[model samples]
Each structure stands twice: as C-alpha cells, then as structure tokens.
Target: MTDARPLAFELPPLRAISVAIPLFILAVLLQPSVSARTSRRLRLALLVPTAVLGWISPFRWRIEPVEFAITANFRWGIFSPYFLMLAVWFGAMGESERKNELAWLGFDGKAEKKALGVEEGSTGHSTATKEDGNAGLRPRANGTLLAPKPRPVSPLASPALSLVSNSSLNDQLPTPSPSPPVDPVQPPSVVDAPPSSVNVPTLTSRKNATRSYSQRHHPLRILLDAAHLLSAMRMIGYAGGPRARDLPPAPKNDKTFFRDRLLAFYNAHLVSSACLALQVLDRDGILASYLSYILPHDAAVFVSATLARLCIGVSLWVQMKIGFNGFAILFYLLHRGTNAFLDTLQAILPRRWSEELTWRSRFDVREYPALFDNPFSKMGEGGVTKFWSARWHFLFRATFTSLGYKPTLALSKRLGVPKRVAQLLGAFVVFTLSAWMHWQALVSARYNLHPSPAGLAFAAAHSIPLTSIYPPPSTSLSFLDRNGTFVFFLLQPVAVFLESLWVALTRKRVSGWAGKVWTALWVVVLGQAVVGKSWLALGLVHGLPPLHLWSWHRFVLPTCSLAPMPVFMR
Candidate 1:
C-alpha cells in the first residue's frame, strides 16, 4: 500500500500479460493438428494473422523497431526446425507403417502363417498351444518325423528341372527294383533329396517379394521412394547418372562437374515443384488445390527468407552508397547465391512439369519429352494455328469458354474474359507484384523514394536502343545485365507482359492496341516503384557507369583511363 503511489507511474504487469494471453491462445487454437490436411489449413489460416502479429509485435514490444518484426520471419526461425522435424517424423512414421503392412502381407519372411499344433519334431500327442499358432512346421504321422507341407510348384520349376536332367542324364543311372511292402513305423527324412523339381524362386520373384515387403510395411516408403526417385530423375546428370539428351552434351573431360551439379540442382528444384504440382492435381476444388499442397507453411518460410534476404541486401547496398559499411557485402553475396539457386531451378521447371504431366497421363516416361516438345515444336512451325491445335491450348480455351456459358458466372469472373484481357491482367499483376517487391527492397536499403535521374537515364537509353533497332538480347544477356536497376525494370515487366500476351493469344484473347499501350505504361510505373532514386542515382553516377568506362578504355582504348577527361566533361 505504501509503494502503490510510486508504482502508479509504471504500467501494470497485467497489461503485458493481457496482450500476450490472447496471442498465445490464438496460436494454440491455430496450431496444426497431426492430420496433414488439418495442419495445412491451420498453417494457411495462421499465416496472415501470424505475420501481422509477428511484424506488429516486434514494434509493440520493440524487438527490432527499425525493421518490421513480424512474427512471420521469427516464426520461420523458431518453427522451421520444428516443422522440418515434423516432416521427417511423419516421413519416418509413414515408412515404418509401410514396413509393417508389408510384413502383414506375407512379404516378410516372418509373415504370419497358419500355426502348426506342435513343434517341428514334437509328438502329435502334445497339446497344441495358442502360442504355437502360426508356425508352418508340422509333426509328421510318425512321432519322430517333422516336415513342412509341400507348397505348390511354380511354373518356372519344370524348365529348370528339365535343364538339370538333360545335363545329368548320361552321368547317372539306377537299376529298377521290385516294389516292397511299405514300412508302417519308419519316419521319412528329406536327406539328399533330388534337387527338388520344386521351382527355385526366380531372381525376379525375389525382387518382387522384396519390393512387396518394402511396400507393405512402409506405404509412405513408396511415396518417399518416389520422392527420392523423382529427385534422382531430376538429378540424373548432376548426381552422376546419364546426361539429358535434350540438354547440351557434356564435354568428355568436364572435371568441373558443373553440368552434373547443375543438373542435380535443377532436378531437386523440379522435384520440389513436382511435389507441389502433384498436391495440386490430387486435391479437390480450385483454390483448395493451390492452397493445400502448393502453399504449405514450410513454403512460406522459404519465400519469406528469400524476400528478407533481398530486402536486407538492397538495404545494405543503399547503406554502402551512403558510406555505411554495415551488412552490404553480406546482403550482396546472399542475393547472388540465392539468385543462382533460383536460376537453376527455373531452368529445369518446365521440363519437370512436362514430364510429370506426361507420366501422369500415359504412365510412361518415354513419352514425356515428346509431349512437352510437341507443343513448342508446333508453335514454332505453325504459330497460332499449331498452338490452337495442341491439346493443352484446346483444354484451356474450352475451360474459359465453358465458364462463359455458365448462368451463375459473376461479372468479376475472369474465366470468360477475352484471352488478351486475361493476359494483360496477368502481366499487370505479375509486374506490379515484382515492382512492389522491389520497392520493399528500396525501403530496406534506406534509399530515397523519389525517382533518380540516373535510373531514368538508364531506362531511356536501354529501352529506346534495344526496343527500337535490335531484337531483344538473349536470356543470357538479360541475366548478365540483371544487376542494373533500369535493365531489370525495363526488361522484367516486358518479359512478364510478353508472357501474358502469349498466354492470351494462345487462348484467342488478344487485346487491342490501346490495351497494350496501357500495359506498357503500367510497367513504367512499376519500374519506378522498384528502383528508388537514392540508390539508383549513386550507382549510376559513381559505380556502374565509371566501371563500364574504365573497362572499355582498358580493353578497347588500351589507354583511355590514362587519358585526362576534358575539364568541362569532368
């Protein structure tokens, strides 16, 4: 009571407790259950709220006030290990169950059999115990005799017996003897039995049995095996298997293992994508499929990490421009490494999807490349006509066309929109998202929000030159120029837009000229959003341009840097 007056200025502990209680409760309520479906749902439901709370809580709690302290990122750090453990645990559980199932199915040598009443050599007089139930061994009529019931001869035994008989026929012969009275009391022992015509199990049957056992005990083993298999298929060249015929052939002495590693990396990427695609294909409903398998909580971790890395990297770059050394190089390297990983992934994805789709349809890998190649080949040869004739094109067109005819279709339904409109919309969306991501990057970098003169100059120079006179450079060139702000702004939007156009045109929904113009304008705005003036201006004026001039002089002019610039020019 005496200290109550002094304590009045201090916030009550209950205030913190009150805020935390609800969050804790919500987290517990939203925690994923054991069921994959339930877990997935919980994960999705928790994502936005958790992220919001994570970010907000940091500010509320002042964990990292300058940066967004969303629980999403922290959750990734805290829960990722647990999530991974869960995946492994579930995977192992699935494997063990499969093994048990296989054993139950008689693939295991210890598979349950009808039990004999007595031990192999025990007298029949001994009472059959329940404990001896499934023993295959049986007591013979003679108290001392023990034998197994003869199993049915397999079809393979005859040919093997015939081969043996033919080889040994001339070497051994036995004289015929008159039949004698059979002994009543004697026990029979199977000693030196002629290599029984009982068909020796073939290698194939043994393999089948092994597979059966594996499948039974570990149902998920097959799935995990398939996962590994798909992964292996993806890694064929990278993991020291055969090279892809479709890809450029490897050099004989290519010791760098670049091709192999690249192939493996690509394959791994495809396997992940394929896993997601499979979930998409298996699930019922449109968004459900996309959300369920495609958008697992673990995936959010990956995406968040990528985004955070990018943001951190750009922030460091900006800080470096402003003479701040903190975190710049680390961010740069992280971004580069991540990009390389993603590039490998992008390269192999289409091939993986094509293969998956083909295999799912035809149940054969041989047809996969042909299936994927046919559409592209057709497009190259027949252009729009060939595309229309392709199966996928027809399917896509028909889906939208059918949607258009539906009486319940809403005005907001994009299904019946003209192909061009759809494409434009798609392009716009992708470009906008990309721009927003870039803008976030700028913010992270502490760059000025205003558009910089250097960025504008670079864009104007590159766009006017490349779009006007030349065919767009190869993807390799684009990749090389990826570091440049203007290049990315100009190129990425255009590329996304073109991709949208291709999709729409393929579906026969080509937009009018005005729509295309509008789309182009949107790209410019999006580009501006991504490339903050403060960051771009410094790089353009002091960094990239000077480096370019230096290289050009050193190699091309041979004495250019040595020469003085005009006073006015300087």
Candidate 2:
C-alpha cells in the first residue's frame, strides 16, 4: 500500500510576484472582451489557457510519500480549471447576471444602487421623484439617506380647532392664499418652513417611496448578492419557456429580488441555503472518512455500515426519544462559526478583489427564511424541473449548464430533436457528469475508525487502496461498480424522469403521506450510500473522536497536508 499526501503548494514571494505579473496582464487585457462576449464558444476558448497554466503554474507543487503516487491537486493545477470554468460560465451568462458575476469576483457596480432607485453623489440639488413629492426631495448626509422630518404643529392650531370638512368649526377658518412655487434646484430651508396659517396636514411620502431598510451600501450586501448571483447563475439557460411548477416563481418585483418588506420571500432562498449546507458537507473531509469506515464493511455485523445507516435513518426519532442533542445546538454553532469566518474573509478582501467577489448589496435579514423544504423534501405536483431547479437550487447548475445543457441543446436543435427530448438528454448528461465527478472523488480514500465500534471499523477496512501515495488509479471508473455512488447519482435522472411521467398521468403531485413514505423508503434504500457518506462526513458517528472532526492529522494519523477538500481546515 502506497501513502499519498495532499498536494503541496508554495509560491515563494518572488515566484508569486512573477506569476501575478502575467495573470494581472491577462486579467486586464481580457476582462472587457470576456465581459462583453457571452458566447459559449468564446468562453470555451478559456480551456486552452487554463490547461496550459494547470500544467505549469509555478506557485503550486506536490509530492507523494510513496514513489509513483499522485496527489489530488495534480488533477487540475491549483484548482485553476474549476476557477476558470466558473469564469467562463460567468462570461457566458446574460448581461444582467454578468454584473452579479463580476460583483462576486470583486467588481464595483452601481447596479444595486440603481436597482433600488438611489443615485450616487450629491447633485447639489434634490433627487426625489415627482411621484414621491417633496418628502424625497432632499440631499443625502455623509452618504446616509434619512426620512424627511415632520413639520411642527402650531399652538394656535389648537386641539379645539377642526379643519375637517365634517366639523362645524371648518366654516370659521379662512383658507390660505396660494403658496409660492418651490425651486427644484434650490435647497429647502428649515427656518423658512411654512407656518400653521397654511393649516395643511403634514404628509410623508418617504415611507412609501424608499424601502424601509436600505440595501444600498450595505457591507455584507455583496455576499447576499453573491449568493443570489451564484444561484441564478445555474438557471441561465434557454431550457424552453419556463413552466410554472418547474422552477421557483421569479421574484415578483425588484422588492422581492432585493427582499423589500412589502414583497413576500420566495421558497428558493431556503433551498439555496440547504444546497449550500450539502455542498459544505461534501467538501469537508469528514464525510469521505466516515464513508470509508462504513462502506468497506460487511452488512452482517451490528452497527456495520448498514446497521449504523439504519440507526441514522432513525436518529431523529432516537434523538427525539432521548431529548438529547436537542434543538440541534451543535449544528447551529458550527454553522454560525463557519459562516462567520467566511464572512470575515469576504470583508477583508480589497475593493478591487471585493468587487470581483461580490456586488454592493445587502442580504436582507427580514427575508431570512425558516428551514422548510430542502433539495430532497419534495412532495410532488412538481416535476424534475421543480425538483432540481427550485428545491435543489441546482448547486452545480452553472457548471452543469455550461458543460452539458447548452452543448446538447445546441446539437439537438441542429438535429431537429424535440425540446423535451433535448431537455431530458441534457438532464441525463448532467447527472452522468455529476456521477462521474463523485466517482473520481472516491478514488482517494484513507481509512479511520469512529470513536465507538472502533475495533469493528478497523476490522472492516479490507479493500485494497484504489489510489495511494505510490501511484494513482488507472481510471476513476476503477472505483465504480454497478451499485455505488455513481449509480446513486445516475439513478436520480431516471427517478426524476419517471416522476415526470407520473405527474403527467395523474395531474397531481406525489406529496403528503404518500410522498413522505416514498421519501423515507427512497432514503432508506436508494439513498443509503449518500446518508452513510454524509453521517461520517458530519462526524456524527457514535464514537468518532472529537479531534478527528477538527484536525487533518487525527483523521489520518501519522501525517497530513493541506487539501483542497476542507479537511485541512477541519
């Protein structure tokens, strides 16, 4: 058995500087061209440069402990291929989302401010719209917009006096003369404000004109906007006229898109959060190690992968019974800590870099959604479109569309195939690609026992290391079989396709008691691999060492290295 280590990366300051010079030049020269051109063909051209850099990036290096062994980072240089792929994806999208894409990459844009109807800089005059009256006709102070103050009521205009048409006192009061015309360019002076002789009740249009909360200039708005941009990035395809049930309803207005108080929050946001959590799970090293402990074991033993899995299936019920791990307190802390650290990184980036990372926008806390539906919590009436697009949030939508959907759709049109066929074919390609990616990920596995049943886990570590430090496996497919991770993902498209047929036949969804039963059964059976993988990754196993959950060395004792998989950080 050969020992493999994660790729080693070191860019000495001088070498990094050398690399940065060329990258900077390329970025400046290509930014405009890439931004304007949304052609898939043009974006595909990026692959050449990316491949070249992946072959020769000076900053990155790797060494395996065993001779002939290869590292994961060796797959794609510095993850540049992934980074470039995402770049090409951003460039291929519509112009509207391009702003979002750029914002994520740390580009400054007036888009959010413009979208919310706020203009930059002082015009040295009022900037309010006619519809909003003079209430909005005020200059910003130190860049902060404030509500217009109310006019003071006069003592002479006593409580006893009634100006209403219904009051008998109305006849005794004289009507004021026509007021002087207000200058549009001239600033309104507070000292010269109209007297109570005018007897006009104060009306505030600021509340109605501006959103109750400001998204413009919000610090973390960029992150929120980045999240939206990333989610929407997956949906940027010509996949037929959108069906109502297929995707989450488009934001009703700018308010909902920006989450103004008046607009109701959409369900897709919750789905996005759920998808992100799943993504974090897979990227973290914990799941992979846990899977290794479980999957390569026999079904006969108690708390074997199967038994542990079954226990997992009933864990919520068990937790409910014990009333321990209540309210998911542990999970809540972990989520907050990780997100806080991520936000800190986002905030620390310089303006140019920040602009590249996100747009100027606020993540409206008011629009904060409660966890209800996730990618898997579907109840029918919704087809595969609804399943993947809305509920699933198509975590890899952008990648999938760029890699599979667009290419197939283009070819299908040339061959004159039906749109539905093209769509299903595209979906199949996506699933296949996903399965393949997962399969490749399985190539590198290191065994570790959970805290409890450690002896059994060690005993079950029977499979030969598919890829080790000495040399990599011949193919990622070598790790696959008829019934494994690949098959699990491959089966999704078929399930979705069949479910679509059922919806067509019945004109109803598979939800409620029936859907719940179906979901649980599917999870227990078809989804066992995924659940087991996740439980391990989450460090949820009974006897998994607490240190193993946080440290790379403990998880794979005797040695560890910086991994692209979040294991290094954990």
Candidate 3:
C-alpha cells in the first residue's frame, strides 16, 4: 500500500479531522443553556470554517487493501458533503427549533441530576416525573437511575420482511401485531417520584451540581461529553426518528435485543460472503463466457451484456448491504465495549464520577437505534417514492433534505411557487445531491487505487495477478461519465414524477402487482443498465480484497474448468 502511493498527500489523513472538530464544536454549542440568538450567531460563525475545511479535505485519504474488503473508505465520497450538510443542518434551524427537533429525534435537552451523579444519597429512589417526557428510567447496579432515553424496537422484525422468500413480488405482507402502547416521549419504567419524600431536584440545582462536578473533574467531563455527543451523532442512524413509518412495529416480547445483534452478524456474513463469491465469479471473463454458453447463441450480444450488467449491479447492491452490516456490527461492538470499559473504570475512579460514568455507559446502549429497515421489502411494495423515502437506507435522508431538498422547497414557496412544484423542486435537488454524493464516492474509490507501475511490477515480480492489484479498467467507458451514477439518481425524481402523474390521473397510488413490475422496470432494468456498467468501468470490484470464504471454482463446482483462484484466494 505504501509502495503504491509513497508520495501521496500526507495532509489527507490530518484533514480528515476537519469533520470531527466541527461536530464536537456544534455539540458543545447546542447545549441547553445556549440562547437561540447566541446559538444562531455561533453556528453561523462556525459554518464558514466548517465548509472551508470540509471542501478542502481529500476524499482519497484512507484506502488500504483491508478497506477494499469492507469499502469503508468509500465514505470519503460523502465525507465533505456530510460535513457541509451537517453544518448546514445545525445552522439552518434556530435554537428553539433545534432543541425541539432534537427532542423529537430522541435527544434529551434537559439536564439530569442523576445523569450527572448530583443526587448524592438518593441511590434507591427513582427520580423521574410524569412531566419528564421520554425520561428513560432504568435502575443501575446500585439502584440509581440513568439519563432519559427512548426505548428502541427490534430492527429485524419488519412486517414487509414476511414476504421476502415468497416468489410472488406482489404478495401482501402480513400486518405486524401492534406493540403494547408506549408513550411517544417517555419510557414506561419511569415511575414518577412522590414530591414530598423524593425531594426532586430543581433544574437550577441539577445544573449547579453538574457545573460543580465538571469543575472538579476539569476536562474529563468535557472530553467524555464530546465523545458521547460524537457517538450520539453516529448512533442516530437515518434520523427517521423513533416514529419512522417503515420501521416494523415493536414485538410484544422484549427479548429481541440479543436476537437483533445475532441477525446483524448473520446478515453481515451472508451478504459479504455472497458479494465476494460474486466478485470471484465475475472476474476474468468467467461470467461472460458462462452466460454466453447458457443462453442461446442466437441471443443478441446486447441482451447478454445487459444481463451481465444487471448481475454486476445486483452484486453492487449486495456489496452495499455488506458495508451496512459491517458498520452495524462495528457500532454494536464499540458501544458494548465502551459500556463495559466505563463500568470497569468506574469502580476505580472517584466516587463522585461513579453515577456519571454509569449514566454514560447506559446511554450507549439505550440510545443506539437500528441502522437499516428492510430495503428489499420496501422495493417489493412498489413505487419509487416508497422505495427511496421509506425502503432505502435512510442514513443520508436528513443530510440530503437539509442540504438540498428543504431549502429548495422553502425557497420555491417563498418565490410563490405552487406547493406541488415546490415539492418537485425539492425532490430534484435531493436527487441531484444524491447523484453528486455517489459520483464523488466512485471517484474517491478510483482515486485511492493509484495503481502504479511499481506496484504492478512488484506483482509481476512476485508472480502475482494484476487483477489483485487493481489493474486499469478493461472497458472503454469513461469512469466519470454523467450517464452512469449521476443519471441513475437524477432520473429517480422523474420516475417519482411519473408515478405521481399516474396517481393524479387514476386516483390511485402506485402499489400492488403492477407497481412491482413498474418499479423493477425502472430500477432493476434501467438503473442497472447505466449505473452497473459505470461502476464496472470504474474498476470498483477490483478494489475489494478476496475474503477467501469458499471459492466458487473449488468447493462449489470442481468439474468446470474455471480460471484458477485469483491471487491470494488460494
């Protein structure tokens, strides 16, 4: 890796911190006491530097052979956009609105006496009040309370998932059983303390106690809180909020937490192994020859090639799923380990920080949200709007909307545009941003390859396959073609418009069997034809290192004379 790009810019690695610094600053500035006007001013002041640093940061910072396996560094494509979007997201709204929005998004704005370990001797008593909306009240090991949290539902129980294995795409999914009514703002375990004996601390006292403790701890509180805030931002997946429409209803039984983790692991392994196997199969003209042999010789070359492109596109989708699962696993382990580490350290630390540490530890698990909804199930339901808005991974929805969609809509409305026209404008902007993000990602991934003569010569000298070292793309198509990634996303709004037009004329939504066919025709057929080939042209697959998880030519089909295992797979 070093040999491939010895003189590669050193600044790219340091510049990556540009995103984190602004986020930490925003976290600090958004604390409850900051006035709306002050927050607005501070945020406005911060936005300039944030945007500047974000724009200048290199996308080709962290690419190694290992990252190719997970495509982790591909995020560089969106890193700048995300920082810009997040900065804009914070700056666009004033303090009151921001607090309300964050509260609705399950972030507590109120200072907690228990959360800061200010309630010195009240270990056995519960401190939550009915008015304390969404106050998550879980008892600690020493019977103290943690901070307010919103209860999370199991991620794997999507109602749409019931029909995943059914051959018919149009199968109506079974309605999930409604969970026991939960308070939108408060967890059920929060038993309101009786006023007389409980001596509920006032807000001022809570703040005072927090201040005193922080003063004593000096920078520890600040550091921990910033880390906590950063982790919080990461944990707030998709920003669909707790009431996301696509989220499956919570189950009656409450034991799905461990089960959900297991499912995530299973999904990561299944999708990753499948993607690698597909990669291996697609290598060295193997899939092309196989398809040609299997299909009639009379089949048009265009048809066979289109089919191959579709296969590659499906593999791309699988690769994306692998990344999602990889992140999910990584987050779960990180949060769990952080909590355990905090617990172990708490005992050895000063007594004043014990409950504070406990608060932070529990906060890790309590606030962790599900990363993805059932995207396939979403697609099978039909309609591009449903797929994009509800079925797709929503991690970037807030970013796109804040950075593009909402602002456009607002500007259009202010300019006296019709509501529908404003909405359409917003949708287009969202898609445009989406296209740019994906295009940049592809560019970043390609840029990171930097396949040098030395690297190739080294491969050759060691009798290594050039494919393993990311040989230049064999296809004639340009890597940065606008017709590929850009067009695919850009055309989504048009498909959405067509669906809207159909609904307007027919007085019906685009759903059911017909909707399924319509969606497939647009996304699977048309989308894959352009985007899939574009990705292949960019040499995206060659970036992924082999997992060596069972070779297709070895265990799967020994009789077939397939190309030998590519490079390190053997």
Q: Which ten residues in a row are the worst by lDDT in model 2?
A: 184-193
* Alpha carbon deviation, residue 94, candidate 1 (Å): 22
Better of 2 and 3 by lDDT: 3
Residue-level lDDT of model 1, residues 293-377, one tens digit each, is: 6678566444433332233223322222222111222333444575565566656789754332221111112111111223322
What TM-score goes with each of the models? 0.24, 0.42, 0.67
Q: Rank the candidates by lDDT, best first.
A: 3, 2, 1
lDDT per model, in order?
0.27, 0.35, 0.49
Provide the global lDDT of candidate 3 against the true structure: 0.49
| lDDT (tens digit, per residue) of candidate 3 on 252-293 | 222354456446545554544454455554554444556677
Which ten contiguous residues of candidate 1 have the minimum total lDDT?
Answer: 184-193
Off by over 4 Å in 1: 1-36, 49-415, 447-535, 538-570
Estimate the TM-score for candidate 3: 0.67
In candidate 1 the C-alpha lDDT for residue 75 amounts to: 18
- By TM-score, the best candidate is 3
